[model samples]
Target: MAEFHQSRKNIIRLIFIGVFAVIAMRLFYLQVIETKYRQLANAQAIVRKLIYPTRGIIYDRHGRVVVNNTALYDLMVTPSEVKHLDTAFLCELLGIDTATFRERMEKIIIRNSRYRQSVFAELLPPDVYGRIEENLYQFPGFELVERPVRNYPYHAGAHIFGYIGEVDSATIRRSDGFYQAGDFIGKTGLERSYEDVLRGQRGVTYLVRDSRNRIQGSYAGGMYDTPAVAGKNLYLSLDIELQQLGEQLLQNKIGSIVAIDPNTGGILAMVSSPTYDPNELSGSERNKKFSRLFTNPELPLFNRPIQATYPPGSTFKPVDALIALHEGVITPQYGYDCRGVYLGCGRPIKCTESFPGHASNLYNAIAYSCNSYFSQVFRFIVDRERRPALGLAEWYRYVSDFGLGKKLGIDLPGEYSGYIPDTAHYNKIFGKGHWNSCTIVSLGIGQGEITETPLQLANVMCIIANHGYYYTPHVVDSVEGDPDFYRTHLVLHRITANVSDTDYDIVTRAMAAVVERGTATIAAIPGITICGKTGTAQNFTIINGKRVELKDHSLFAAFAPREHPKIAIAVVVENAGFGASWAAPIASLMIEKYLRDSIATDRLPLLKRISEANLIPEYILEKKRRIDSLNQVRDKLEARRIVAR
Candidate 1:
């Protein structure tokens, strides 16, 4: 019985031992047979990252950088993975308080995809990047990503340079299948205009993630990644040096300077005062800095060249003359009496000049900036029947043909359509048929609802320079890629009208008179034969419900090389008294500097004086002095009255 039991036990032991041997053999086979698969799985569990592409560069016509990329670090955080992250240390490193950190984290959690780790913050500066990157291992949830932010090489063209900010929910909704959340987009100016051409295709890489959400290895040996095609470069027609100079000229003023090539309508320089530095609104501190700028009283974000409108002043006279001449309402030989004031319009509108009973013809009238002559001519053109004025309806039509009272459809974004009051406009204000040409007669002199942007004033000058045609003003001369693109995109803008050759000659002669012997004598560029017009418009200072007189806005518009025009410019100095004093000289200097490529050193003294001069509130000064005088008189009168009583 014992021997039988031992045999059975041996058999059982053998059966159990055989089963163990079979299991071990199977395990060995599986480990060795699937070695390649196991190796791939293990490798994928370790190291993988996705890389974004670099943005393209923006250059000026001279290949100088206008907008370029600067490297910045993005602070990426994965909330769940940040188990033992040093919150205080991280906040200190990033220059953020705990409340801000918490708020940002909450926003990131809400906005990010649940399937992937989130990008909490972006565009951290180098100093912040250095601090956090050193202790990256200590924060498992956070990582550093390097990318490019837009940088302007030159500080000029602030309004035209525009800015880039992170895409919001509104932008995402209106993205039109182009962008995703958290992308930066151009908010204004040419940056907004050419966003598609400037921002290139984005590439992506497939990164494997484990259950713990740690990156593994590249999927499919990097075959799944698509290389980013870099964005195409933009070559703007801006002369950076000239643009900087223009900005310097308009410093601390509430006006603009627009310089354009009359031939090509290529904007050379567009400067508006109170401009903020482009770099100030870039990257991490963008929101804070931009908020301050946006709420600024002077309106730095306002593009005074195209967006801000003011009376064309004397600058609109040339356009008025052209329209009058084209309509054959007046002859060059036609004369008007300049008694230093206009009296026929039932109002004593005073003239700036000291002309006494001077019988001025077309040339003399323009040269002297005779208000009486223009007022007579305007009344003749609008209200006359036989050789009569064309009336407001026809007049408005002609002006609209010149691209007035409408957006010029410029390439840059945010061009404002200036207001031109017509008969209908009068109806809105004083009821239909309640007002006539006499009510709005000041429009003839570039006041009373006759407003235009600096860009429009420049365009008007270009029209006169070209004898009626102008190319639609644009900043980009050429785009990268095929030569066909440049050929197709570069377009010329010309006006189709019934302007007679004789009329153009007559207007040119009048403008020539302005430079040869007119109010614009200060604009004479030695031998440049520059034709210009000066304007001083009466503006009101309304305070405490009183309309008080203030120093007028001075304006000057000119085209250089009278015979063969190269550049057309428009300058405005706000409340700087006469156009000759402030606006004309600056316009002349810029013309000489640009056309001749060098300006006279002797003129620097004059320009430097202008640079130092301030445009203060004239009414304030006048009121203070007037009150003192009135008080003295009142005291004397009271003493006399008291003695009599």
Candidate 2:
């Protein structure tokens, strides 16, 4: 009986010790190992606030501030903490109705939990913000958070600078908790491309809150507060004055202009027509103005320089001339008798000039943009090989080397690689062994399935200007914090094509002749040697299931000073009749403006005429009129609703 009692007492003591150890471990875990419980406890008394750093400023080549930051307030609300709120007074201050306020609250609850803070009113106006700030104490859960918004002082470069908006659910999910519901992010252009470099690291500040959810002071006297790091600034290669001039010239037209510094491949100016002022997309009226711009039939949002593609027209003749010279099939003295037409195949090809000796040599052919001469040259190149397929593959390789039919890897996004049809493309259409060089002869004249972007055309000029080598074009010249990275990652390295310098000289001289006394004579600037080409691309569209031809698109590509060329440019005027009439003159004026810093006195009339020209298609105008009518009706209804409120 004594032994049994002793064993029972030992077992009871062991059970008590085990229970005590388990309790101590759980207390240690709650106090040190796990942070959720501690965070929950702190949430009751501490409010965490995010400090947004000023986005980096963007400067033009001359160090002028193009994009800067301005202060704006976002009205934030914590639904769980909102109680005893004066709904009518808040609505009055916000310029909203009671129904609108309730709708916003319900959306916030659905998009974000009731306990979390979300933006109730974004980009508040000055007067409304002032009124709410003065009476903020009356609303316990509402707070005014100051954030920086982009400001364009010059009211230009809407496409280049892009715009920022609130982060979407997809962005938040991919941000790894770095971004939340109300955070702003870049949507396009340089803003989107350099988002990481321009968006600085966010910092946090902890504040002590009273029982009534009012901030008392900084928690722990600001011991845990972190400071925000400002984003790195960007210095762009864009010449703002040149860009403004390009925009001015392209007004009332649907076209694009892209100019590049040939030596460094830096973009001097990029303009897409029908652009809006950058200021229009900022502040309290952004959403409304954006809706109007988006719904416009003209598509002002389209970035045409890199995104839109059109046939190269006669501007592509120089590339063909170079290829022919490289293959030893043509020479500077090569001549073809073109008596107004070419009857080499089943179809007769027409020539623009019917005069004698206009295409007697390679120089005159390029100067006149003779269709017969190039048609014969293309046949020579293709038939040189045993098979047509082999010859086409060779042609494709040479063309790709010029940066055609592919993206140039520009810094901006949404670049389209223009199409270049190869043997397989022809085989799929006409069947194997069914088509030959004569069937696709139109390609030699920069038409019939050959398309290129304005950017690609500009780069082609760069290749010619550099005498067979060119650099990848870029907008941002340097980053403020990391210059080495910019140089290493960007196109500091030169890319060389397979053409020889001698062939380039032959082509370059012919192009100069084009501006001197040939088709693009109007592109000539006094005291400056301009080498240019004119193109009139055939435009077509499908209407009512039938292919309808529209007015030709005017195009011109040029490089200036001829020796040690400084600027290379391309211009495309949609639905414009002839290249020399509109596109060539525009390119020349831009060149003179860049080189001479102003238009010459003799060319002022030309500049005035081109700038005042309206080339928008009639169909586009009709669609825009319909959209404008709808927008006006909606505006009237909105005004009526506001008056009723």
Candidate 3:
């Protein structure tokens, strides 16, 4: 019996030892080798919540709000946490039907993980969000996330303040995980150019959840939580009043106007006709309205100021004169016989300025816009070199310094580099050294293969106003952080030519003469010293195997108070009869408005006339009619949707 008792004690000790070893191994596995299981269990009890940051506010030069923010709510769901809920009631609250609800749930399951959160409904306005929040606790897995959506107070500058949209797969891939699938991003214009600074930084928070998935407040007493940083605001140089006035002047016309502060190279106003209210691209009906506007036949989406290109026409004569003076090919006293026509290059170039001073001298030629004198001067500059190609290339260098034929590097997207014809291009088309100065003399008057956008033309005026230098024309004047934001981006460009201050003075004087007594006299202001040039660009295109001519494009470029210039402007009106009639007056009025902040009672009729004038061609009108018809359907649908809510 004593031997049996000893055996029992040994067996009991061994069994206890074996049980302890097993327990130790299991504890080690749970702590190290099989750690993922612990994390999974933690995830079930702890909620990781994202904190969104507000996008930047945009202000005009005078501290007026251009873009602001309004609060909106998004409905979120975790499919795995969802249980038996009132589907019909939820769908009605979210403004979705039964079919839509089913489709969304299926998409969540197929496209996203069941454990991860997904957006069920997006962009609910304050009213809708307030109503839905009262009944949200009734649903088990539903949550609300607050976001700040864009709001436009004035409802102008649609293209300037591009709309934000959800990020696509391509965007996410390009973002390097910085942006997820549903994150909002700027699509174009200033919004796109300053996205990094304007998007700010996101934050995160951790909260505990009960067995029923109800929030139990901050986890770890908020020790690990981070607060979101709001985006930096932008102070723009644009004058909203001036911009609105310009838009009104350009109404019913298919063109653009660009006004810049000559001293700072800050854009004062930029107007593209056929523009839409920016608010239409914001708020609840944004996507639907955007679809209709995107497909409109008039192409209101096109940003014309920096994108549309045209020949500079008579306005180019000033540059030609400057080039000739700089090269010593011609002097200020240079004169040529002008009988209102140019008969040199096997073609008769006609001119409307048959007045007495048309051929007297350089100043008179420029003021009167005498095509013949400029054509002769252009030939002199080109033929100065033995080889015509060499002379043309030399001339091109001067024009290129004025920021033509290249992007101005403005803080906007989709700027086109206007075309500048080169010797190689000419030689390839017309053989080596076969083309002479007379062959392409049309270039002297800003025609042929040369083209310029209104923004570039306006910069040319800014350069002239500054007497040979310019800061790159930019819209944003200052940013919140980094006081050197504007200065760092400001490009101070100087002309690479031997142009003298006297030459600019002489040019400014002649430009003043243009408004004083020449073709652009209609643009004269009572007290302001206005300098301007009128331009009529010939429109030529091939039709039915023959070149056909359309109505001329009216254009003008000007600056005010020639001594200490404040504003420089360029306006182009498509299919208008004369620059003096349409473009000149418009530019003049804009200059006056910017300087005096009021238009004289006398100019009211001119403003009314230009505003009411319809310059779109018949074909464009017919297409617009079709777009209008389709938009009627969209309007009805939008109304019904509003009533349904």
- Superposed on all Cα atoms, the candidates' RMSDs to the truth, in angstroms, are 11.4, 3.8, 3.2
Q: Please name the candidate that would achieve the greatest TM-score relative to the true structure.
A: 2
Least accurate stretch of 10 residues (summed lDDT) in model 1? 42-51
lDDT tens readout by residue for model 3, 1-645: 999999999999999999999999999999889957776677679776677799999999999999888777788887766788898888777777788898998887775666667678778767778877999888877788887888988877776777788878888889888886557888877888889878878778888998877789999999999998999999999998999998888877888999999888898998988888887776767787788878876778899899999999999888888888878888888887877788988789997866666768888887888899999898998899778999999988888999999999888899988888988889999999678988889999988899999999999998888899999889999999879987787879999885999888888889999999888988999988888889989876565689877788999998888989999999998888678989999999899899999999999998898888889766668878988897898789967985675
The runs of at least 3 residues in candidate 3 whose Cα sits more than 4 Å from the true structure, single-residue gaps closed, are 1-44, 95-112, 125-131, 540-549, 631-645
- What are the TM-scores, per candidate, against the unseen true structure? 0.84, 0.92, 0.91
- In model 2, the Cα lDDT at residue 471 comes to 80
Residue 401, candidate 3: Cα error in Å is 0.8
Candidates 2 and 3 compared by TM-score, better number = 2
Q: Which candidate has the highest lDDT of all? A: 2
Q: Which pairs in model 3 have colliding backbones?
A: none
Winner of 2 and 3 under lDDT? 2
| Local lDDT at 2 for model 2 | 100
User: lDDT-based ranking, best first?
Assistant: 2, 3, 1
| Cα shift from native, residue 586, model 1 (Å) | 1.5
What digit string (tens of lDDT, one per residue) describes model 1 on residues 172-197?
Answer: 77877456555677788877888887
The CA-based lDDT of model 2 is what?
A: 0.90
